[model samples]
Target: VPPGEFIPVAERFGIASRLDRWIIRTALSRHGAALRSGALTLGFNLSAQTLSDPQLWDFVDNVIEETGAPHSGIGFEITETAAVTNFDAAEQFVRKARERRCRVSLDDFGAGMSSFEYLRRFPVDTIKIDGSFIEHITQSRFDREIVLAITSIARSLGCDVVGEKIEQQDTLAMLSDMGVAFGQGFLLHRPEPLERIV
Candidate 1:
């Protein structure tokens, strides 16, 4: 899992730019080794602060070179709020990442009212349907509709959709019925040490 506290530290220290580089370098070092062993690609969560940095591209270039990891082997996950707040810069970053063959995903989709608009603006390759909606799929028709809407939009945009926080077998079956392309949750796989995963 991505370190949850790193972004807060970067913001508090006013060195978010440097922290972004450090994240890329540190994450790639471990993830690159995994790639070499033919493991699944690693995903990194991008902080909103990092998304706005003009120098982020430079950092990305340096890390990619240092790690010798294919752009396709790296996926960046940015929250919906972050993407909308930094829409223009995020769009450019997404475009550039795509050019480098890196995949971009809109994380926490459907958290706010403007998610669809954000999706229209950014060319993301994946949309991770927020857990709030996924968790209550059976309890509320509205939640199911929201997920369905996201699924339809993703399909139309030619993007894969991943459902998160799937805790029950029935929930997994519901999501499968909706034809979600991927999913992640304890029910599917829990986090284990790297050595244990293999």
Candidate 2:
């Protein structure tokens, strides 16, 4: 199932945090050497329920310590919507995560009404533009404008911009021209099994 469909269900059922914990443990453990050596950086998308879980980082730090990945070379991707759900908690979470040397990213950035609010407050290192805007960016003037605006705002705030769902070469070129620091989609790499990736 697509994460958009299942994540909400997992969140409602209080299983999201457990799932997140499992992902963190598995990722750090399996990729410890590369992460510790700063050869690779792994990013995990966290659910809103997981963000509110007070024990989340302690668990993460323990796993990091056990793996001996100091930089952790791990970044947490929290959707803008999730960060807004519990503002204070989210703020504290971002601060603590960064303090521990893990990078934080605000995912699906323009999808939220309070995108600017989070940018002003949260010390996230990056903001990922919503895929909705990238889907037809090559054809839509409006999409291009929005992407430009987001990239400009993010740059002004000292946060890097990441463009998602970049499928075509035109889209990739456009995003690079617009100053997006990263791109992720089937165009760059199709999803592969963990065994193959590791």
Candidate 3:
């Protein structure tokens, strides 16, 4: 199942934590060796349920040690909605992860209600601009403005900004002009298996 569908179902059944563990374990088992060799960086999305569970951190720490994956090569992506749901816990997660040399990013940044507020609370390494805004960024002045504003704020806070759903060259060029640090979508590269890339 897609994460969007599975996450809600798992949360409703109070099994999100178990699902999270499986996801983390599977990801590590598949790519941990390559990650340790510095072949590529891996990013994992943690559900809000898992983020709020204090015990999750200990589990993650154990997995990292067991896999010998470099902390610096791992990135945890906390959605804007998730970060806002439990600000304190999310802050703790980000801080602890940073302490372990792991990167923390605020995913789907503009999709949430309080995007800017979360930025002030969480010291994330990157902000992924929501694709809704990027889809028509070139044609719509409002979308362009939103992207500009997000990029500007992120830059001032020393956070790298990434534009999502970049399927057009014009959009890519616009994002580059706006100083977006990264772009993700079909125009650049399609998503491929980690093993294939490694």
What residue runs in model 2 are displaced by over 4 Å at the alpha carbon? none
Q: How do the predictions measure up, each by TM-score?
A: 0.88, 0.93, 0.93
> Each candidate: RMSD to true structure?
2.3, 1.5, 1.5
Total backbone clashes of model 2? 0
- lDDT tens string, model 3, 1-198? 556787898888888878888888888877887888888888888887889998987898899888887889889999977777788999999999989889999899889788888888888899999999998988999999999999999988999989999999999999999899799989998877666766
- By TM-score, is 1 or 3 better? 3
Q: Report the Cα lDDT for residue 21, model 1.
A: 67
CA lDDT of each candidate?
0.83, 0.87, 0.88
Worst 10 residues of 2 by lDDT: 189-198
lDDT of 1 by residue, 99-195 (tens): 9888899898888778877787778899999999999898899999989998998999999999999889999999999889699899999887666
Candidate 3 residue 93 Cα shift, in angstroms, is 0.8
* Candidates 1 and 3 compared by lDDT, better number: 3
Off by over 4 Å in 3: none
